[model samples]
Target: MCKDKIAVVLVTFNRLDKLKQAVEYYEQQTYPIQEVVIVDNHSTDGTIQYLKEWVNGKGNFKRKTVLLNENCGGAGGFGAGMDEVLDEVRRHELDADWVAVADDDAFPRKNSFEKIIDYYKSLSDKEQEDISVLCSRVVNCGKTHINHRNRIKQSILRARFMAVPEEEYDKDAFDIDIFSYVGTFIKVNALQKVGTTNRDLFIYGDDQEHSLRLRKVGRMQCVPSSVYDHDRPGLGERKIGWHSYYDSRNHVYILKKYFPIQCLIMRCIKRYILDMSVFSSNTQQERKLFKTAYMDGIKGNLGKNSVYKPGFEITDRKD
Candidate 1:
């Protein structure tokens, strides 16, 4: 028997197709889920209306689509959705033993939930209780194969994108030292003890901050047996325009909030050196964008109204 009733909280902005596919994958999970909550980030593209219609047609799942009046970035949307879930769990109104946080663009494997549940059962009671945050191996969505070695190399590079090396990627359970919000399964009790995601982050680094806090309370693990296909397309080429701005500014916020002064100093130095090397090989436009992002990183300027943009809409339904 499944000891935990899972609540899958998905946050989406304008990705309607991806969201629908992700929900379809969720419906196929072997392990039972209590509910699926779709927190709409005020998308203007009729996403809310679509979800409303979809949820209306599906009566088997206790699905909820929350429409935020404003478009809070991913960080704020997730925190708010988590707050709602935790409140319901606390009141015993919702039978949620675990809160699974996933991106709308990702799809879990058919046996992903079963694998996670089995791993949970295998652990000692103490270990089970202590394991608050659990993550699954994420593979490229479009690609059918998993590149374990490349993932390991990416992790070692400490590149802006966090990825596990292909060789280190195992299809088994293991403890994780870092916290990843995307496609992570969190214990309800552990989340309550550690607190929710920081809304101040407003965009990036929020997961890392929350994970750091979770480590203090219980164990975090990467379950290789539980895998999900991340729907992000392969990086055929680099597009470093607005992305550079956010990436640079987010790192600064992370360092300021979590890292010690010396550590932050060393990080900045390393990043500067790396940025210079990267820019040396890139086009003029790419170099310019990277330079802008790097400067913004130093100034800690995340941009104006980065939390929400205009033309965004909110809805109460899944459509």
Candidate 2:
């Protein structure tokens, strides 16, 4: 036997083809999933209708779907997905011990679930109970994706809290301060304590924020043996859209909420350099987007920006 039952919470927006592929990968997992909650972020594509038709009391796992009224971005969609899973548990439909986070475009390898389950079995009882999040090594385009684990910088003076050195992934299991939502396993107990992911973020920095909170409740580990693949093609309207705004805004929100005052003070001088280096853009619309985002972030104004919808161009026109 299986001592643990895992559920998956996946959120998608208009990527029906990728969603189908991800579902196929999930079906191939050696370790069985008890339930799967998929949130469709009001895709203009036929995703909602397809999901409705596809989930007809078939497949090895119990399926649940949440169709949103608006496109709530990854952050909101994930929170909604978690809510659906919790609702199913309340209804006694399933008892899920672990919640695996995933996206439409990314998926675990064939033996990914088996590897994670094996690692979980190897841990001591105390360690197993104390582990809040378990992350798998993720690769994209033959390169090690560092988002699986982020080692903390561990200093109040540092503006940023993480340093993602790819070399740190050689260990069988390593302690990590943060784990990305993609390809990570979270304990239901931790969710009961720390709460579901922050939906107010609406897009970016949501994973890091949730990870930091979960760290306070229990240990997070990255198991190199468990690997997943995340190959997000850097194209489409999503590439040219409002992510830059969310990136700048959510970064500031994270800094204010988690960083020490000493770090905040240090960031004062480095903020401009940071912006120019990472967020700098020549387009008039892009510059304005950054400025507006930075302002809202500092003022604690968050959530989906009314003007900056994904796949839509942000223009300088006042009318």
What is residue 142's positional error in candidate 2, in angstroms?
Answer: 2.3
Evaluate all candidate structures by whole-model CA lDDT and list the values in order: 0.70, 0.81
The runs of at least 3 residues in candidate 1 whose Cα sits more than 4 Å from the true structure, single-residue gaps closed, are: 141-163, 236-239, 270-319
**Every model's Cα RMSD, please?**
7.1, 3.4
Q: In candidate 2, which residue pairs clash?
A: none
Model 2, 1-319: lDDT tens per residue?
2367899998998889999999989988989999888889999788988999988759978888888999888899989988777767778887988899989878899888888888989988987878888888888777787755787774748755464677777777888897788898988878878888799999878988998899999888888888888977445544334888888788887877888767655664465555434454435555566667777888889887888867556544331
Q: Which stretches of candidate 2 lie over 4 Å from their true place?
A: 161-163, 234-241, 273-287, 312-319
TM-score against native, each model: 0.79, 0.89
